[model samples]
Every structure is written in C-alpha cells, then in structure tokens.
Target: MAKKVALLQGNEACAHGAVYAGCTFFGGYPITPSTEVAEVMSVELPKIGGAFIQMEDEIAAMASILGGALTGAKAMTATSGPGMSLKQELLGYACIAEIPCVIINVMRGGPSTGMPTGPSQSDVLQARWGTHGDHPAIALAPSSCQEIFSETVRAFNLAEKYRMPVQVVFDEIVGHMRERIEFPEPGELEIIDRTEPTVAPEDYKPYDTQFGDVAPLAAFGSEYRYHVTGLNKAEDGFPTTKAELVDAEQRRQIRKIEDARADIESNEEYQTEDAEVIVLAYGSTARSGRYAVDRLREEGVKAGLFRPITLWPFPEKRVQELAKQTKGIIVPEMNLGQMVLEVERVVARDCAVELIGRVDGEPITPTQIMDKVKEVL
Candidate 1:
C-alpha cells in the first residue's frame, strides 16, 4: 500500500497524533497559534466516537480533561501563552491528583499577552515552574511539525505510563508552520494505556504504593471507587494533613520522574563529538541552531548543535559532559533568556556560556546563531 501523507500544520498534526494515541476526550478552549488543534479534534473526534468539548474558559477546559481522565479517557487539551497561565492551578491539581492527561502548549511571546501570533521560548521555565509547587513536570520541545506529531503521541505515553500529566510544548513558529507528514499506520507507533488495577474494587486505592511508585489507575465509572483531591493525600487518596504521609507522598511523586530521568530525557546532537563550540537550543530555535552548525562546519569551524527534545528534567548529565569537552556553548532563544540559565548552572563554569536572546516577536535566525558561534570560537 502507498503511504499516507499530508501537508499539515503543527497544531493539526498534534490532533491527529493524539487520536492515533487513542485520545477519546479533548477538552480545550481556542487560543491563537493553537486553535487548530481544537478545531481538528472537533471534526475528527466525533467520527471516532470520541468526545471534543470547547469549554467556556481555559480553566474549565483543563478541569474537563481531568474529569475525563479519571473516567479512563485518554484526555488532552491545547492552548497558547495566555491560556496556559489560566490553566496553572488545575495543572497543579493534575500533578497532585496524579491525573493521566496530555497538555499541548503552543508557545507565543508573553509575560501577559505580549504577542498573540509570534513565536517564543519564554515558556521554557514556566513549563517547569508555572504551577505553584515543586511538582514533577514532563515537558517535550519538538523542532518541527512532524516532531510535534510524534512528540504529542509520546506525551500521552509518558503521562499514562507515569500516571502524571505530560506536556508537549512547541513555539508559534513550529505550531503554525506547514510541513508534509507521513501518517503512522496502526501499530506503527507504540501506544500505551494507563495500567488498570487487577485488585478487587473494594480494595482499590488511587494512590496505592504497594503496586509501585506509579500505581495502576482505575476508571471513575468502573467497578473501582476511590477518592482523589488536590490536597496532599495518603495512599488511599483521601486528603491527609499528617506530616509523614504528606512528606512521603510528595517525595514519591517527585522520585517517580527523577529516578527515571535517564529514561525520560531525550536529546539530539549534531557534529558535537569533536566540537570546540556547542550551540544548545530547543523548539523552533533549534532549527536555526542546526543551520548554524552546518554553515560553521562548511567554513571549517568546530561547531555543533545540541537540541533537547525533552526540555524538562533538563538533560543535565549529557550537557555536563558537553561542557567539559567544548570550549564554549552558545544558546539562541526567542526569549530574553530562560534555558541559558539552565546551561550555565549545569556547566558550572566548565565552559563559557553565551546567550543570544530575542524577544521582539522575531525568531532567532541562523545568521544570529552563526555570529554568536564565531564570537564564542
């Protein structure tokens, strides 16, 4: 059979990818640079017997998905900068409640409605710390539309596997750009569903630790009846103020991701093995970084690119190694400076770190990156 291919925008591909991952519930509010995701879902979901709802507001959208997730639906929502800000509280709720859902954040410039259609990587830190609390966060930043699709599916897998929320974040450039994508056939990509409990209904605990760090989740309408709340909870899932239980629960939630960091972190390196200078970037900025690497190589500069697909749990070990090997690292971002701070912290003065940041609604281009590379060298 011939392959299935289509010219798709990043947001549209994300919706298709979510369906391929068995997403049966989509609760979202339309927002610039990300509304296509909801539009696509609305049209496609009904045909698959799935549900797509445009909530009255961003918070409601997030709440709807959390409710859907508890009913054993592979739920998801998409939004841009402003909407993400509104969803923070429920995002924190998902973290503490251990809800399995995916959030697609197509980033645009913002402290508050800074730019509606422009690309920005400013949310890099927000994805990790937006919600008020030291909760575990899994966020992926894909460079292209095709990657947006696959990463969206992977986002769902990680959420289900860990029984926590996972975020797929791409900037407005990648989110709105058009690209030809070949659809993955059925069974072509791995699809993971949350583990269902094997225990009897009466014995089921939503946060049971005996099963492991990530307990099996039971459907809300199923035979299982369990409590869930945003409050610090015990293994039984009811609110608990006991310091010991609260502390343990908090530690366990963090440990589940931290302990599995090796498995969770994903990055791509181009020509970095013998590099003297490494350009580290993610999202759409990495596209320019890659172009800069190639151009620098043509001119015989020992430059390379390091792109982190998994933005959070920031690929520290690999970066530390790169810092030791490279004389300097140049970071180009669409923001004033967010991820560069992370690189500096990890490098810890092992190598000189420089930032080329843009925040005037323009993307960091190859010429800018190459200029920084030459200066670094």
Candidate 2:
C-alpha cells in the first residue's frame, strides 16, 4: 500500500533518511538552516529507541558521532557552513580511523558566518578540501526534498559499506523547501551493514588488509581491543612514521574507493545522448538547469543535463566520455566556478567549457541558464 502525504521540508526528510538507513545515534549542535535536522532527530530518534545528544559545541558534536560509530552504532551529525568548519579536524579523524558515519552540511553563506539563514552552494570545494590531509571522501547533494531523504540513506550506506565518512551537502533553499514525497515500499530498498572482523581476537590486526581491501572493524570495548589515531598507522593500527608503510596505508585508503568506483557513483542525464550542448549543474541550481534545458528544447535547440549525485570521486570518466561527443559544457554553480574547472580539466578535448555562476547569495535562474545555453551554442 502506498500513502501520499503533505510536502516534507528537506531537513526533516534528511533526518528520516538517516533513521531509515539504521542510524541509531545522532550527536549534533544546533545551527541555522540545519537545526531542523537536529530538532527532528531529537523527537524521532527517542521514539524509535535511538540516542540523540546535543553536544556543547560543534567539535564535541563531531567527536561524539565518531565515538558512537566506533561502538558499532550507525551514527550521524548535521551542521551548516560555520559548524562544518569547526568539524574539519574530526572529519579527518573519521577518515583515518575509518569510522563509518554520515555528516550532513546544509550550506548557508560563508567564509565565516556571512549569512546564517541564506542559501549558498559555496561549500562544494570545502566538502572536498576542508580536511587538512590527503584523504578521499564521498559527498552527495540533493536538489529536492525527496532526494534529501533518499540521498541521506545512500550516504549512510556508502559510509558503512566503505568504512569511511560520507557527507550529504545541501543548501538552505533545498533544506527549507517543501515537496510531496513518496517513499519506497517494503523490501524495495537494500541496506548494508559494516563488515566484522573474521580473525580471532588474539590474531586480529585492526588495519590488516589480508582478507580484502577493507579491513573488518571491531567495535570499541570489544575483546579485539586496538587503538585508532589520526596519524598514519601500520596494520596493527599503531602510529608509524615510516615512508614505505605510510605509502601503502595511504594507497589502501584511497584504493578502497578507487577499486569500487562502480558502487560509489550516482548520477543522472536527461536527453543527453543526442544533444550537442550539455549543462553540468548540481545542488539547487540543477532544478533551474532542468527548466532551462526544457526551454531550449522548445526553442529548437538541443540541450541536456548531467547532474552528479556523488560530488567527490567525481564521475571523471563519464564526463570525459560525454565530452568526446558534446560540443560544449556549461557549468552553473552558486559560487564562482569551482566545479567548472574540474570539468574543464577532465573534458580537455575540443569541447568548450563555459561557466554560469554567482556568489552573492543569489540564485541563478532558468532564464540565465537558457541564455547561457544560447550563448554557448
């Protein structure tokens, strides 16, 4: 039986997604544009027998989620731009520790508290390079309320599957928008749990890669006790400064995803195969890009959309392949051309790469995109 309900705000749907993905614990500090996620989690998690805690600050919020995940809980935390900044060091910790957790960043204007309530897509680069070191991450952006819920589930699944942190990056517009959503029915969705250690506790090496690319995880306080630190470590999970060991560990961390790229990527293309001009947009701007593509089609011009659901570990091969056929690529973003550069680099053939961007907290509308399509054509 399917049920239709009133529109859900994106933030609320995000919280629902986390629950559906089996998140048993949430630790976060409230901040504008993202507070609703915490608010809903507070009410819903307790009712469902999950733990919800409001930490003293964003740093504690991040640390608490990592602790929860270490104890075998599906844990997550949500924040906005400023809060995301505060959580960077711990973000890196989660990466190195290989903690399976989800971090939701509902973006607002930034640098440092530019506009707490306003929408901004300026976090694209931050989500990639915010952490200090060289660690790969998975980031998903939802353009609508339904995606907010669906992608949240995917974030948790990806994190647990890969034993790493995943990010759900949304902006204020999508976070606050209300839209009717129909969720999946029973048995339609697949959930993944973390892999457990197979070796005996006495023989277990926490970071051992003998079994496979992903080393099985043992929960904190388990008989298979081991230490986890941010510094590069050996198979036993002890801090090591050896260059060769460091190289191997780093490659293992990166290759876990690189080797499994097929499972990690999610994207969509509309009328792109036969179109000569394509628009690569993401987040909220994608909605308008769709409209612009439709308008161009109506005016006898061929335009298509390429939207990346997984922002990091970008779909480089796919875009490069598309570039071989397309004549031009127009990238529209809320910030001033961050992702465009990546597209240009990957699609380095004869295709022209164009940018349609704004950074003053104003949205790029369908009209502007339609015009850009014409200009690029």
Candidate 3:
C-alpha cells in the first residue's frame, strides 16, 4: 500500500503527531511560531471526535489540559516563550500531580518577549528548571519537521508511560519551516496509554506504590473516586504535610525518570566513532552542526556531529564517553550559552569545550561551527 505524505511545517506535523498518538483534547492559546500547532490541532482534533479549546490565556490553556488529563483523555497544549513562562506554575502542578500531558513549546527568542518571530534555544534550560521545586522533566528537541512529528509522538508516549508532563521543544526555524514527511501508519509507531487501576473503586488509590514506581492512574469520572491536589500528596492522593510521606513521594516521582534514564535518553551521532573534534548541538542548530562536520571532513578535518533528541535527561553518559574520546566539543546554540554549561559539567574538563552562541534572531551557521571546531582543535 502507498503511504500518505505531506509537505508540513514542523508545527503542523506536531499537531498531526499528537493526533496519531491518540490525543483527544487540546487546550492552548495562539503564540508566535507556535500558533500553527494550536491552529492545526483546532482543525484536526475535531475530525477524530477529539476536543480543542482556545482558553483566555496561557495558564488557563495549561489548566484545561490538566483537567482533561485527569478525566482519562490524552491531552496536550502548545505555546512559545512568554506563553511557556505563563504556564510554568501549572507545569509544576502537572509534575507533582503526576498528570499525563504533552506540552509543545516552539522556541522563540525570550526573556520578556525578546523576539517572538525569531528562533532561539534559550528555553533549553528553562524547560528543565523553569518550574519551582525539584521535579522530573522530560523534554525532546527534534532538528527537523519529520523529527518534530516523531518526537511529539514520543513525548506523548513518555508522558503516558511515566505519568507526568512531557515537553516537545523546537526552535522557530524548524517550527515554521516546511518539509516533506511521510506519515507513519497506525501501529507503525508505538502508542502508550497510562495504566488504569485494576482495583475496585473502594480499594483504589491514585498514588498507590504497590504497582511500582508509577502507580496506575485512575480517571475522575471512572468508577474510582480519589482525592487530587497540588499540595504534596499521600498514597491515596490527599494533601499531606508529614515530612516522611512528602520526602518519599518526592523521591519516588524523581526516581521514576532517573531510574529509567536509559529508556528516555535519545541521541544521534554522525561520524563520532573516529573523529578528533565533535560539534554538539540540538534543535535547529544541529542542522548547521551536521553541515559543518561534513564540510570539515571533506577538508580533511576529522569533525563529527552529536545531536541530542531527548534533551531533558541530558544524555550525560554518552557525552562523557565522547568527551574522553574526542579532543574537544564545540557547542553552537541559538541562545547566548545554555546547553554548553551542561556539556561542560559532564565533560568536567576532560576535553576542551567551546561555544558559538547567537541571540540576534539569527541562526548559528555551519561556517561559525566549523570555525569554532578548527579553533578548538
């Protein structure tokens, strides 16, 4: 059978990917570069008997998805820099509440509406630490339109499998660029749903640990009726101030992701097996990094590219290994210098680390990365 394909913007592909992942509810407001994601969801969701709502603001949009998620629907929301800031509090709520939802954050220049129409990777750090408190975070950064689709689907799966909020982040360059993408047929990509409680209503507990690190989540309207709150919760989901219970709950929530780090981290290496210098980048910058590596290799420089698709967990182990093998790692990002810090910490001065950063609403070019690579070597 012939497959279905389309020329789609990254945002549009993200919306379609959410649909493919069985997203039944979308609650979001329009924001630059990311608005197309909400627009596409508004149109596609209804066709599948799914629901889409444009809330009054970003926080409300986030709140609506949390509500929908509690009711057993696969829910999601989309936003950009400022909108993402507005959603931070509730994002923390989703974290503590262990709600399964996806957030598509199209990266634009930031820090009080820095550059709404420009691409930036500044939010890379924000995605992991914007929300208050210590909580587990899963974020994916896909470099191209097709990857945005698959990563969006993976974001949904991770959120469901771990029972928490997962973010799909892409810079404005990829968000607005159109590219050819072949849609994955049903069953081609694995779809995961949150595990439902098998116990009876009277015996149900939202945070019951007996089922393991991630307890089965019960829907509000289902036979189960349990307490839900933003405060530190107990096994039954009720608010708790007891230190022991609170500490254990916090550790459990964080451990779910940390323990499964192997399953969540994803990266792509191009010619790193035998290279003296490596260019480490993500999102739109990765495209430039790949080009730089190819150009340098052709010129007889052993340069390679390392692209991190799953950014939250940081891919620390692989990076540490690369650090030992390579002479240096050059990080070229759209932001001033965010992800470079992470690489530095992991590499621990085992190899030279350099940065090629930009925040003038312009992307870091292959020439810039190549220059930095040459300087490092």
Estimate, for each residue in 335-369, the C-alpha lDDT of model 1 and write its tens digit.
Answer: 88899999999999899999999998988889998
Writing each residue's lDDT as its tens digit, candidate 3 over 83-153 gives: 99999999999999999999999988879888999999999999999999999999999999999999999
Q: What is candidate 2's lDDT per residue for 83-115, written digit by digit as tens?
A: 999999999999998999999999988789878
**lDDT per model vs. reference:** 0.93, 0.90, 0.94
Runs in model 3 deviating more than 4 A are: none
Off by over 4 Å in 1: none
How much is the lDDT of residue 111 in candidate 1? Answer: 81
If scored against the real structure, what TM-score would every candidate get? 0.99, 0.98, 0.99
Clashing pairs in 3: none
Error of 1 at 274 (Å): 0.5
State the lDDT at 309 in candidate 2. Answer: 88
